[model samples]
Target: MKEFVWAVSIICILLVFGVVLLKYLSENKKYKNSSYGKQSQKSFWKIISNQGARGEYRTSQIIDKAPFKNKMLFNCYIPNRSGDKTEIDMIMLCQKGIYVIENKNYSGWIFGNEKSKNWCETLKGKKYFFYNPIKQNRTTV
Candidate 1:
């Protein structure tokens, strides 16, 4: 009976894993066909797994729904004077001017100011620190 139970548990785990993989594949195919995915250089795995990538994709969708005519570039890399590259999440070009976007997807209460190098996210009872998005975008711009 114990052996049978173990086998059933293993089968159940495999089934759940299979379902998740299939869902991921389906979403990836759909994203690849979308205009936002075509413009984004980020891999499908990154889009699904990384919070920042997902945030950028969500921002792109919002931009697409806007009434104004604009061109959007995603996941852009610009060479800096220090020989390293600065990555910009999204750049929107319109009749007004070019706008640079730094996307941050964080839950809970976030605390930070423009001058702070790092920001704190209070989730549950814990605190998490992340680089300031404003500072990050300032370097990119």
Candidate 2:
């Protein structure tokens, strides 16, 4: 019984130490930066937030490669009467008219229609949902 108690106590102490060390490393960016922080180079949660920026960067590369006289405006922010801002990703001004483009950089199987209030994505045995990009872009027009 005493040996079992000692073993459990040791395990608890080790677990506490591990948690503290991890917290310290995460809080101190220098240690995380110096170490092989490849994951940290990516965004927090590796989810949909910064994924839009990444998708935009990739799309921008493709657009930049095209030879055209159209003007592409990126990240245009408009202020509302409430003093809040609405962000539009890419606006292409061509001979036709203004084309508003919104990108959703999501992985796995996406399940939703354009009219749906929210879009769902199934990734890694988990489900995630976000707003429909089409509806979100309509306000930019």
Candidate 3:
């Protein structure tokens, strides 16, 4: 019984030391990498947000590349005077008319009809539901 207690105490002490060492190493690595990393490099969450913004910017660039002589504008997060104070993601002005674009940068198998109030996306086999962008845009208009 004395030997068993001694062995258990030693194992417990080793485990505690191992955990502390792992924590210290992890923090040290992060601190070292932070010094070398650039501030402009976006993190995981920032990349996700920027993906939609990038798409909107790309769409405007594509339109600019075309031979259309008319004026074009890309307005992001334009606020509405409605009670809800909704904001439009992007607004494009072309020869035809104004286009209200709502950018959704979601990675998944999206499923839904244009008439449906909500659409479903299966991201990594996990289901996610979001409101239709068309309706959201119409509400802003």
lDDT for position 75 in model 3: 40
What is the alpha-carbon lDDT for the whole of candidate 3? 0.63
The predictions' CA RMSDs to the true structure, in order, are 3.9, 9.8, 11.2
Q: How many clashing pairs does model 1 include?
A: 0
Quote model 3's TM-score. 0.54
Give the 10-residue window scoring lowest on summed lDDT in candidate 3.
31-40
Listed in order, each prediction's TM-score against the native is: 0.74, 0.59, 0.54
Better of 2 and 3 by lDDT: 2
Candidate 1, pairs of clashing residues? none
lDDT of 1 by residue, 1-141 (tens): 999999999999999999999999998887787667997777898887988788777778788888999998887899866779998878899999999998899999999999999999999999999999898888874
lDDT of 3 by residue, 23-141 (tens): 86775454334311122243433432567654654454465566765444334344465655566655656677877778777777999887999999898879999998877777875
lDDT of 2: 0.69
As for TM-score, the candidate ahead, 1 or 3, is 1
TM-score order of candidates, top first: 1, 2, 3
Candidate ranking under lDDT, highest first, comes to 1, 2, 3
**3-89 in candidate 2: lDDT tens per residue?**
999999999999999998887657445323321122234442332246676576556557655676566776778875567898877
Off by over 4 Å in 1: 1-30, 41-46
